[model samples]
Target: MPKAILKLYLILKRERFDIVQYSTTNAVFYAATASWLACIPVRLYAQWGIRYVVFSGLVKIIFKQIERWCCRCSTVIEPDSMGNLEFSIREGLYPRDKGRVIWNGSACGINIERFDISQKDIWRTEYREKIGCDVHHLVVGFVGSIRADKGCNELIAACRSFFSNMPMARLLLIGDKVFYSTIDKDLRDWVESSDQVIHVPPNDQIPQYMACMDVFALPSYREGFGMVIIEAEAMGVSVVASNVPGPADAIRHEVTGLMVPVRDAVALAEALQVLLRDPAKRTAYGVAAAAFARDSFEQKKFLQYVLADKEQLIAEEEFQINHAGKHV
Candidate 1:
């Protein structure tokens, strides 16, 4: 680790880079250490989300200290969500004044033009048919990684409960089932047979899949920000998400979509039922959601935020050249 840090320091020193930007905490530590060692003028860290739950107490503390150290070395810290910014400030990870909020809290916004309602109908027909769903059946879809931390188990449980009551309802999961546990095997195998559950792998044409759902569900316990929610909304699909930090930021309850309690399968089931039973309400929500997403989470805004101050960064390079010339 020390040798790697020294190598990074030498590279940064040779390149004479300005405004070094680090994406994750581990990267932040390396950048901070390198910048301090090489006397680099500016450093910045992007705090996307908290990952303390994934690690133990001592490791969490160590990671927090690294975050603080990186923040101290950097000129700015870019937090993805309001919740994250506030948490960073509270935890002394970054100074309140230094942290800047990017629009909509997502890494990037969906391409609204490409994800049009006109392109959705064909996908809707095919996917519904594949799941044995008819016009009368309500289809709910989840488009992301099939991991336990993403509340996949909770979703499966909720769908199981819903299936017992409403056989006409279908839940389609569209993503890679990469992170399967021993406990998940029995339930997952059962879902494959009995329930109206379909496990599809990762595909390039995700927007097409988003088009097929009447409702999109993301009951994740933690997220930096849920990007698929925005995509689903752009494709005119209403969503049901957990009332946690990141999902709450993405979805406006009773407007664009519905939000339920974290880890509460019963609440999730009830929320799903609301959309399943009322086709009119679902349509209204989807329309409103697409509009809201278009207005608030535009791709142009994401580019503007991410590309802000680039000209200034370039100008700094010119200024440094002129100053060095004068001295020489």
Candidate 2:
């Protein structure tokens, strides 16, 4: 850690950067420490999510201390979500006055043109046939890293329960099976063997895959911001997500989508079943979700907020320097 900090310090000093920003916990620690050492005029620590939420004991303490130190070293603390911003303040990780959230709270807001529903018909037919599912099949999709922390096990269980009632419903699991060796053997075998489940490797055609889904599910244990929820919504698909901080902020329960208790396979399955049975409700939610996403989570609006914040910070720094010079 010391060596990494020193290396970053040298790089910052050499570049003479006007502003230094770091994202993610690991990067925040090293970059903030280095930026402090180099006395960078503006040091930003972007808190994407908290990993220590899932950890405990001595390990959690160590990580928490590191996060606190990173916060101390930074000139500004920007969290991607309001939930996370509140969490950081409650935990005393950073001063509330020093923190700010960008727009509606996401790393980057949805690109409506990219995830637009206009191409749904074309992409749905192409992807559904490629994945061996008929057009009439009700597809439930999940896109992200397939691991325990992402609630893959619970998702599998939910699909098992959902399939018992809606046999024709299909589960389309996208993304590579990261940490596959660490996952339980039984669950791994089930995913491989189930004809009702189609596990596709990660691909760049996310917008197209999202267009093919009737409902999108993300039963994650933790998330800084569930960007995919908005992405799915932008593509005119209703969502069934865990009632966690990030997801809760993104999804308006029973309005844009349903939010079930985290790690509860039964609730997750029941939510899916409810949407599958009611085509009218699904269409209603999808339409509302798309409109909500466009109004609240547009990329242009988010960028404007962020760029304006940066300019304000820079102007404040210049004012301070000029005022100090006059006093001298």
Candidate 3:
């Protein structure tokens, strides 16, 4: 670790970097420290998610402390979600003054061009048929890590309950399943045994799959920001997400999508059923959601916002450095 840090520090020193930024825990630790040691004026750390919150015992303690040190080394900590920024400040993991969220909360907003609503019908028909489902099937899609933290177990339980009512409802999970004990036993059994569940590996064709969804579900326990929620909306797919911080910002409850309490299987199931049963309401929500995404969440807007902030901060830092050097 020391050798890696020195190597990075030398690179920054040689390049005479005006700014340095890092995101992941490993990268943040190394990059932030190297940037700090190299006396870079703008040291930014992008907080994507809180890993320590998921662990326990010594592991949690170790990760939390490591994050704390990373925060200390950074001049600014930009969390993609306001909820995470609040938690980081509340826990003193990052200073309140240094933490900020750009726009509402998304690392990089969705590319609306990819999820072209003009070709929605074509993509929907194509992808649904490709996945062996037709217009008759009620598809509930989820696109994230198939792990405990993503609320996969809760989602599966909710779908199972919903299936008892609408047997035709299919759960299309479009991410790799993680082999961990944290995954529910019932979920495992159902996935292995039931034909209603379809597991697709992660691919570049996310927008295509997203267009076919009757509804999208994100029952995540934690998130820096639920960017997928916005992506689904861009595809004109209404969402039912956990009323957690990250997703809450992405959705307009009862308008763009429904928000269920975190880990509440019954609520999740009921919300899914409501949308599935009422095509009019679902279509209305989808229309409203797409407009919301189009108006608010474009990748270019996020890039502009962040780049403007970066420019301003870097200028301020350099001005201060020159001011101090004159005194020295």
* lDDT of prediction 1: 0.79
List all candidate RMSDs to the true structure.
Answer: 3.2, 1.4, 1.7
> How well is each residue in 297-316 modelled by candidate 1, as lDDT tens digits?
88887778678745555577
Rate residue 224 of model 3 by lDDT: 79
For model 2, state the Cα shift of residue 314 in Å.
0.6
Q: Global lDDT of each model?
A: 0.79, 0.89, 0.89
What TM-score do all the candidates reach, one by one?
0.88, 0.96, 0.95
TM-score-best of 1 and 3:
3
How much is 61 displaced in model 3, in angstroms? 2.2
Model 2 residue 77 lDDT score: 86
For model 1, the superposed segments whose C-alpha errors exceed 4 Å read: 54-56, 130-132, 182-186, 312-328
- Candidate 3: 10-residue stretch with minimal lDDT: 176-185
Model 3, 1-328: lDDT tens digits are: 5998999999999998777889987888899889999988799888888778878999999999999999999998899988888888888896788999988679898888887888889999999998899989999999988888888888999888768678788999998766436788877898879888898998999999998899999989878789999999998999999987788889999999899998898999999999999999999999999999988888888789988989888889979989999999
Pairs clashing within candidate 1: none
